[model samples]
Target: MADLTMARLHEAMTVLYAISLVFYFIDYLNKDAKAHRIAFWLVSIVWVMQSVFLGLYITETHRFPILSLFEGIYFYAWLLVTISILLHCLYRVDLPVFFLNVIGFIFISIHTFAPNQIAQSPVGDSLISELLIIHITFAILSYVAFSLSFVFSTLYLILYNVLKKKKWTKQWTRLPSLDQAQKGMSSALLTGIPFLLISLILGLQWGFASFDHFSIFDAKIIGSFISLLIYCLILFGYRKGKLHTTMYAWTQVYAFLIIIINFFLGSRLSSFHFWN
Candidate 1:
């Protein structure tokens, strides 16, 4: 019964976030401070409710709530919202906050509606030690950051084309400037790469310690190295001015696709590292 109530609360939180997203969109389009203020308060309320839900789960389980795919998604969405709130409070970045929350709402909605995904049992701490848990957590966070970078990069490409054609839209106006978008993309990559590297190192250590027949040639392992190399190349190309802006952005998009494939397909096909 308590679990059901928590699930309902999470659903309600998603609904509230959706409502807040609409208000933020309106504020973005119409420059309405009142609407923006309302959206801010709505987000805060949802965050508070989510915190309580997470706290209850942690209190009951004596563990973090990110031991399952569903819980990881929920926690990722929570992190996005937390960042959104911080950006709003610190920088007053209204449109970015709106965009971030849009993504957050999508993630939370998936968690709310996907019963099969949520029904999967969480991996216990007994099965996976603390180092493995940390590795997985950081890896997931790095992927989330990379995902956001991809979004920003996509926006940058779209706006670049719009500018080249000398066409402007209201939506274009609401988006960050091309330079800002590029910076955002770069910043996310910079933040994610270190986490990804650390996670890889820790994951390797955990795998070797936990498995009797761990191999570096596993599908997931190879995919991780590929992803890391591709991102590094993209960053290098960007820094060296070897890749054009649009090209760099497109590279990020493709790299993100590879990440998606590796995460969903490669992980499943791997002989080891199949956490899902």
Candidate 2:
């Protein structure tokens, strides 16, 4: 029961942390004071929650939580969150604080979703189920990020066409500026790529651990990997001055279609994933 409660608390803290990152990203883009304030408070809450957990661990284990790999990851993530909050409060460095939390989020996700380390569970079999849960959760979050980027990209194209045609409708007045849309689309992609990469890694690890006849060339696995690579390529191209304006928007649209297909068709084609 205690473990279960801790698990739920860990999950809740991660969700809060992710939301705070979103706000921080907004503040990073536009320097919105309200957004910055909200982010700071949310991060503060997460830090407090982490501190409570650490306290509980110390009380129960009678030692600091840096003695094992699992405990070490939790401590590391906690330290990052602590430092990130301090940076936000002391220096008001938006970009550095945002990135610090992102790294912290990744490590926290790993620690939260990691398999039980109890002596009762065999070491090899421990990863079979919990890692799958982590893989699916991370993958879904990545899709959510991608979906948001798709909306921003779509808006960019709409605004671009409207401007090209010179149809200055009041309805179009509320749309974000072209630069804003572009930045938002890029930010979403940046947030998503690391998540998808982590999901792929955890998924592959789960596959190897869970299956007797696992193939690295499995259809779903390949499709997901390809999706990650394409997004990386798109981001790389944009950063290199190769894609922008209509071209950049169109690229994201096409890449999103690949994700859609990979999600539905790839699942059906995979021999084990369908059953799993």
Candidate 3:
């Protein structure tokens, strides 16, 4: 019975995300204020509902679902959606909603379609529940924030590059000025920094305590650190006034690519912080 309800909620969440994504695209393309507002509202409601569902899930299982990659992906998507909501509200920028919707749709869609690949029911053991939540809460939050920022970075890069080459002026110009896009990406980075720090700190603590300090030196950790450095460097550029919106945007896109490679870094490489 609980399984059925959880499955239904997941389905509902996916559909809601898809609907929100469609409306956001419409808002982006048509520049319709009504559609934009509707899209934003939908994202906000759906995100809050997702949090409620997660709470229900943990209550039912009495455990955190941070044991597997698919579960991690689900949690990551949740964090991204939440941060996307918070960041968009803070910035009040159109482009953030547009790209975040698109990226959220992709993340949700892949997981929805590959259900068998992602879901795993770990034993609800007592020993790990508290520690599990502690680990997963930070784990998903940080990586997911980085993941969303990567998407924003990608958009900034593409938009900036297109403008530089003068490729799609009339269409792209309607999207957002490069300056607005740049600001939006920077905003995402700025907001994401703290989450990443928390994640990294908790992860290190867990590693040192468990395995008798036998931490796995994996690719994800190295890649994530590299990603952290890349963004930091970009931020430094901003501080020095050398990272123009467009250039900063370009770095974000590259940063996203680097992050994607890091996904496999967790699975394949040996230095990943959370190589599960």
Candidate 4:
């Protein structure tokens, strides 16, 4: 019964988010302040409801609700919403808010509605050391930041193409300028790479401490190293004026794809990181 109630709350939150997204779209298309205001209030209401649900979940479970993959995804979505709200209030970054909410809603909805693949081996307290917890947290955060960078980079590419063709659509006018998008992409990468490096370092430490035997050849570890190297090259290339802007953006896209694949498939290839 409690589970049913929580599921209902999750659905309600998703519905509210959908409505808010629609209002944001309307505002963006029509330049209507009323719609924008409505969207803001709706998001606030959804945030409040999600907070209540999270509180109830934590109280009932007696644990932070981010241990398992499913819970972590949901919590990440909540963090995005929180960040979006803060950006809205402090910076008035409505365009980023729109993109953030779209991604957040998709993730939260998936966690709420999809079958739980990690259920059989849910990340129990016994399996989670302090170092492991910190590693996972920072890794997830770094991925989130990288995902945002990819979004901005993709936008930059699209805008670049539109400008190259001398075609100015409403989207071109509504979207952030090319320079703004490039700056945003760079800022997100700069913020994320440090967290990724720290996560990798802590992950190695945790692996060494927890496992009776550890190997650097593990699929996840190898993928993480590759990801780090790719980003490092991107930074170096950009700084040295060796990488074209379009190439840099596409490289970020490719790197993010590698990240997604490794995150989802690495456990299947190695026992050390297996969830089930």
Q: What is the C-alpha lDDT of each candidate?
A: 0.82, 0.76, 0.66, 0.82
Candidate rank order under lDDT? 1, 4, 2, 3
Residue pairs clashing in model 2 are none
Residue-level lDDT of model 3, residues 205-234, one tens digit each, is: 665665565553546656666767887887
Model 1 per-residue lDDT tens digits across residues 130-222: 887798889888887887788788788888999999888665676778888899889998988888899899989988888788889988889
Q: What's the C-alpha lDDT at position 115 in model 4?
A: 87
| Clash pairs detected, candidate 3 | 153-252, 153-253, 217-270, 217-271, 218-270, 218-271, 218-272, 219-271, 219-272, 221-272
Clashes of each: 0, 0, 10, 0
Better of 2 and 4 by TM-score: 4
TM-score of each: 0.90, 0.55, 0.75, 0.91
Show where candidate 1 strays beyond 4 Å.
Answer: 116-122, 169-171
Q: Once model 4 is optimally superposed onto the true structure by TM-score, how far is the C-alpha of residue 82 displaced, in angstroms?
A: 1.8
For 84-143, candidate 2 gives per-residue lDDT tens digits of 677557755455456557867887888888677521223223343567656665776687
Error of 4 at 144 (Å): 1.8
